[model samples]
Each structure stands twice: as C-alpha cells, then as structure tokens.
Target: MQGISMSNTMQRRQFSVLACVFQSIFVALFAIFGEFHNHEEDKHNRVHANYPMFQDIHTMINDAGRSLVVHCFGAYFGLAAAKVCHRQNTMVVDDDESSGHSSELFAMLAKAACTTATFMLSSLADHLGRFNMAHIQSSSLAGGIAIGAFANVILYPHHAIVVGAAAALISVVGHPKILEKRLSIQDTCGAHSLHGLPSLLAGFLSALFVLLYEPSEYGPNFVEQYSAIYPQWKGSGQPGAHRDLRTQSFFQLAGLGLTFLTAIFGGLFCGWVMNWSLLNQVQPKPSYEDASYYLNAEFSLFGNIDNSGHGLGSSNTSIHKCGRIDYRPLDIEAALRAVKRAGIGPDAIF
Candidate 1:
C-alpha cells in the first residue's frame, strides 16, 4: 500500500498530507498528554505547563482521533483474533500449512479498502448536510471490521471488496440520525454500527465460511492450513480427534455471544461506577461543547455574566428572562408558554 501510494503522483500528495497531519498530531499529543506525571497523587497538577492551550486543543483532537483509532485498531484486533482462532478446535493431519505473505497482504488490503469505503460513505454526509462526517466515516468501517474476523478465509479480493462496500452501505442506512429518528435510540458514537454490528457480522461470516470450506480444494494438507488455536489441534492427528463444521460454527457463535455479554455487562458496570458521586464530575448537558465545559467560551451579551468575569452563570431565571430572546430564540407559542409558566401577563412580556 505504501509503495502503491508513493508510486502515484496524486496519491503522494495525500500521503504527504497524511504524514504531516499524523506527525503534527503525535508531537502535539506528546507535548500535551505526556505531562501527566501521576493521576491520583497529582490531581491538581497541570498536564502541559508550557502550553496551557495545548490541553484544550488536545481534547478536541482526541475527540476526533478516538473515533479513527477505535475503528482502525478494532478491525486489526478482530482480524488477528479470528486468524489465530480460525481452527481453534480442529485437529489437523501432519502438514505444514502456511498463508505465506497472503495473510499480511489481505489485512493490508482490507484496511485500505475499508478506509476508502468509509471515506466514500462519509461523502454522503455532505450530500445530506446533516450527519457528522467523523461519525459517518467511523461507522462506515463496520464492514471491514466484520470481514476481519474471516479475512484470511475470504479467499478472493473481490469478496473482501463486496463485504466492505456492503458494510459501508449498512452504516449509511443505519446511521445514528436514522436510528434516533426511527427508534428513539441516541447512539452518541455510533458504536453499534462501527464495532458491535461488524463484530457480530464477522462472527457469523466465520461460522459460514467454516461450514462451506472444502479441504479437498487446498490439498491433503488443507486441514493444516485452516486449523484451530488449541495446542491439542496444533499438529497431525487422527480423524476421530478432529471436530466437524457444526462444532466449529457453534464455537464461533458462542464466541460472539460471549463478546456481546461482556460488552453489555461491562458497560453497565462502568456506567454505574462513573455515575457514583466520588467518580462523577459535573453531569454534562446536551450539546455542551468542550469550550463550554472548560469555561473557555466567550460570554454572550444576552446571557448572564456575573461580576466575577465568569462566562455563563447557572442561573435559570436570568437565562429565562434575558437569554431567552437571543440564545434560546423563543417562538410565539413557546413565549406564551413561558409567560404562563412564569405567571407573567402577556403585556408584561411584550
């Protein structure tokens, strides 16, 4: 992929941009995030004393970077796990099975194709002009991640492309906005589409692949090529010791179930811990940006700013009265409702 990119004049520019962006980001990240000497002991310590603003920018960058990192590594990890465990329970007859360079090349191709598909899917966000491009791009990689678990078993380049394209299509149709509007579920990060769905898809695909796999096509040593991870199945074995397709499929499904349960229960436990008073920071408001959270926002003239030079005060009364007209932008019906709720006469509001 690197060679192909460098060989193309048009792609070289993109490579240059990508290199610059990553280099700048990492340098900034090291300058910013590397400052935390200790977490529990030095709670009051500043992360980057030299660059106070670096922390702020770091937060924004992290917000974006987290999505990409999650998608990329998520696929790689899933694929690696699948490859290692592809023949987890199978006992193969003695034969040296090797993917050679094909395994590595397949992973590389999947990554490139998946990323390209994601970017293409994100372009639709511009067409709709509603969804966040980051969310769309991240979610679009669902197909690649799903395919990762069975990438080596996938056999052909065109098949991998189809899986990626299909996943991207699914992402677009099942994006957060669509789910929120249709199902009343507000998935903030589109994790279901990006990681959850893809992982599930991969599991199912792996099971199907195992069921349909023909050892005869690859030769007498074919069993060696698609064997399991367990040490018992590491080498040549009697036919009776080897597990069948049905068992392999069952294990694959079981693994997916285990993953699902772990995520669900783990998330629940983490949520409970995070909401605990000792661990909880201030509860975040809807649509409240990092600037607002960090108290870096400029005070709106219509909003309340106390004499202490603070940005926006947490005064509902002031917000209702002064900021309503400018910040909230009340319609006539809403204005009337507010008047009635406040027990103020229409004349007084006018």
Candidate 2:
C-alpha cells in the first residue's frame, strides 16, 4: 500500500483521487485472510509450528498487497498523463484557471485519509461485533458527499477545499466501541462510506457545479437531471429555469432523498449476495468428544463435563458468545499443576 501511494504520487497528476480508489480496493481484497484478527484477549494471534497451508495463504496475501500497489500506481499515472498531456488545451488557454485547482486534489485526499482510518476502526469493530462504527462511518461519508457536492457546485475552489477538509477531519476522528472478538473483511470494509456517501456528495456537487459554473446551459440540464431521479418526471432536455423557490427546494430534497434510499438497499443486497457465496465453506465450531474418562457418564458428577472423557473432545474453536468456556482457564490453576505432576495435559482452553 505504501509503495503504491509513493509511486502513484510521483506519476499521477491528481494523487488524491487515485488514493481514494486504492483505499477502496484494499478493503475489498482484505478478506483473503483478513477474516479473523483483533480481539480483547487475543488481538495478536499465536504462531503455528508447521502449518504449511497457513504460511502459504499468508504469503499470497502479502503478494496481493504488492500487486495492488502496482496496479493503482499505473492507473493513476495514466489518468494524469491523459488529463494534462493528452487533452487539447494543454497550455495558455485557461477557462477559469482555478477551476482546475488544488481543491479537487485536497478534497479527494481528505476523503481517502478518513476512509483509510475508518477501515482500521472497522477491523476493531469486526472483532467486537458492533454495528455502531459502521453506522457512523456511513453517516459521515453521506454528509461529506453532500457537503463536497454542494461546495463544488455552489462555491469556489478555496471555499470548497476548506469545507471538504473540515468534513474529512471530522470523519477520521471517529472510533468504535462494544467490540466483538473477531471481524471479517466483509464487515470491516466501508463500502457505504467510499461509494454511496461520496457518490451522493459528488452528484449534487456536479449539478451545483454545473449550475454555478455554467448557468445558461446548466439551468435546463440541472432540472432534467435532478428530475429524472423520480419516476413521474422525465427531464425535458428543452430546458427551463426554476422560477419558483418552492419548486427548486422540492427537487433538491427529492434528489438527495432518493439517492440515500437507493444506497442503503443496494448495499444490503450486495452484502447478502457475497455472504451466500461463502456460506457453504464456513465450518461450525468444534466440540469436545465424550471418549475421555472424566467426561464419561460413569464419572459425570466427580469429573465434571469433560474431565475424564475417553477420546479427545470436539476440536471446534469458535466462540460466538461474549464469554464461553476456555479450554485453559486461569481458574483451573490447581488442576493444571496436578496435570503437570502427572505428566499429562492438553492445550489451553480457547
């Protein structure tokens, strides 16, 4: 990730936008072994002695990161080349020179930074099992999108840049509570933030940008574009001014409302599809077997549940609830000592 950012920054004209896209892609691919990590008791996983498959998978994950960096680097570089070099007016003929200013860069960079931090917090939330972090990230993204869009369309570069920066700062400071033991890449990835929220901001800003920057042509197209969001309204490209203040307000609100509505539903549907695809591969938690002598019915009272079971108990390791029985409980210090004296013991309880 760092490699891509550095290389892309040198090659890409507007590094900020490329940064945002890369951030999203990383979250999407994190699932390749990022399904489990972060915890109250075991945020750091223990090393396995001879797990060749685990090592192989981990190596593959590292490789993906390097490849992602390279891919995004090339993409950003290409876009920059096209925008500055390939375009017609590459020199003196500047139409509103500040229009192609640094504000766009700042806005995109801020969004990327905030979103990246949100992804990390998302991982923590995944371990803890709370939706609050995700909700906050989504809401922040939505608000930023709206603000950026409005700024882009209604305000100048300086003002737009300032407003965008403030919004992004507010978003990055956010963190989550009520954590679960582990988090999956799917849940942690803040798609709602990067896409729907920003897209919303971009949409309104685009319209507003059109209106403020190109009023004569913008008036007609903005109305059509804004209205097309509704079923009963087929935008008449034959353009007309929004005469009534009430009509203008109604349309703006309608566009924003529909945008949010679609976003939530679309996100849920996508998550469901992905979840279904991985469902069959999911394994249930293991349970201890009853073969141990202590766990046998004959010594149920004296030995406790799994004390003297004949065979090894179930190998299931996952604990869905907050606190489950630990295979190696600290409270069993006395028993553990006795087992050491007897020269017999099993691994710690999970």
Candidate 3:
C-alpha cells in the first residue's frame, strides 16, 4: 500500500528565521542533554563540571551553520514555487496579491532547513555506522513541528503561481523515502517534533515574514488583515518590529512542553502493554530456559532496579559471596505487566 507523506505548511524563506530560532532552542536543551549522555565518561570521582549555558550557545551556533545549508534548499524550493502555482507556493501568489510574501518566504526557508535536518540526520547516522532510523520515530513530528509552528506566518503573491507548483513537484521527488517510515503525527519520535515543529514554525513565520518584509507590496487588505485574528500580532503586516521576546519565548516553551507531554502520553498509550523496552525498568522473565537463563544471567548482573528490597542487608551483619554478588532472578514479565497496570514495578538488588 502507498503511504502518506506530509510537508510542513510553511514556505521556504520564512523557514530560515524559525530554523534559527529553533536551532537556538535545541542547542540549549541538548547542551544539558549531551552532558548527561556523556556523564559516564568522566575521568575521576571529583567530576568535571559541565557548562550548560556556554555549551548550548556553542552547540547551537554549530548546528545552525549545518542547518543553514538545508535552509538554502528551502529557498530554492520557494523560488521555484514562486514560479509555479501551488498552495505550498503561496509566495508567488501572495507577491502578486500584495499579501504577506516576505514572511511566507522566511517560513519556507526554515521548513527547508528542517527538512534538511531530517534528511541529514538520516544520512549522517548511517554514514557514521549508526542506524539510519534512530530518529525515524522523531521525524514525523519533526515534520509537523516545522509546519505547525510556522502556521501563523503569511505568504507572498506570485505573478506566476507556477513557481510554487514546480517547487511542490520537486520537493515531492523525495516523497517515497519519507512515506516509507510509517510514522504518526503524535509519536514523540514522530515527524511531528522532528518535522512538524520546524514545518509549522516555518509555515507560521513565513506568513509573518511575507507580510513583514513586504507589507506594502503584499500585505492583505486592512479589513481582511484585521478580520483574520490578533491584529497586533500580525507580525508580518508590521515590519521592523519583533514580537515581544517574552511572549515569543513563552510560546516556544509551550511548544516544547506540548511535544514533551504528547510524547510521554503517546509512548505510553501506544506501547502500554509493553514494558522495559527502553530498559528504564528492569524486569525478569517468567521461566528461564537453560539456554535463555545462561545467555542472560550474566547480563542482568548489573541491571538497575529502583527497589532492591534486600532488607538493608540484615543478614547477621556479615557479607557472604552470595550476598555481595547480586545474583538474583528477575521477573521480567511480571514486572512489566505490573508497570503497565500501575506504573510501578518491583525494585531489585542488581
């Protein structure tokens, strides 16, 4: 069966700004995250201090540079769209109608950048001998994120709508691979955040950029603009000014939180019956066949469990080889089932 493929709703140009914005945000979070990922590699018990804020600034700047190349593809895509006639090619149409073309263009650019991120991530993972699908689950939402976040942005009027149409056609050239991923919008690893975040952000920002950059040239009629919504928030219609930093920041936070919550719930709901799949929880099997037991016995020796229930070592204040060695059976199935039922599992010693 043929699969569904999604594109972020934003135009190419506007995507640039949003990619910049989101790049900044991703860097901040990843700085902290990267340190955590590498925490085990410390040289000594004294622990090396990690500078999150400084690291975030540096990481984001580097990520932005790489992402910029992807944004250029979006620009080319937008330019092509301006030559064609497609909804995705609003820039061409908006430019003609004197609507918000600048904003739309920026949004498109940002979306293109994110699209590039998705493709690059896929390719880089493989190039480095890593699984290409590491972010497959995250890609769908990533697509949506790009599209949705930029939804509020406006587009330009193209004297020739064919530009957008052509751009859409070209972008679709890679549709097959994206469709094959079998991702859902709500999945944390879904293209929503991975793609949706950038797509939407691009789309909305493009709308704003389209109008902001060339309001007199392509902004909507005064009546139409006011009727749409948030007159003061028409970031595109009014150029040379930025949205309140605080408000924009709040929205960004909300966007991240929304995704985080959705990811948590989606993962739980979709895999409710499954447990310990991520190894967050340690559970044992119902029965241990000799083959399986021997195979996994040594493996779980250092497995982490929340509760060991070893009774605080009250065994005559003496440590035996058995006591010292955390050689205990793990009830993987039961523990998993219990977690599914109550979100709680038995704690083990090892």
Best by lDDT: 1
Clashes of 2: 37
Give one digit per residue, the lDDT tens place, for model 2 in 196-242.
Answer: 33443444444344334432232433444333322122243434432
lDDT of each: 0.46, 0.35, 0.33
Ranking by lDDT: 1, 2, 3
- Which wins on lDDT, candidate 1 or candidate 3? 1
Per-residue lDDT over 1-350 for candidate 1, one digit per residue giving the tens place of the 0 to 100 score = 86554456444345434634664565566555543122223334333313212232222111111222244334334433323322212223212222236654554455553355554444444433222454444654576576766665654445565666667756655554554344443344565567656656666666677666554433344445444221123233744444555665666565555545544554545555655678554433322323223332334433342344232332232232222232332234533444454565767645
CA lDDT for candidate 1: 0.46
Best by TM-score: 1
Q: Give the higher-lDDT candidate: 1 or 2.
A: 1
* CA displacement after TM-score superposition, residue 143 of candidate 3 (Å): 2.5
lDDT per residue (tens digit) for residues 189-264 in model 3: 2232333234334433433433343333223342233222222233535553344424443444443433344434
**Which regions in candidate 1 have their CA more than 4 angstroms from the true location?**
1-136, 178-186, 228-241, 292-350
Model 1: clashing residue pairs?
A: 87-227, 87-228, 88-228, 88-229, 94-236
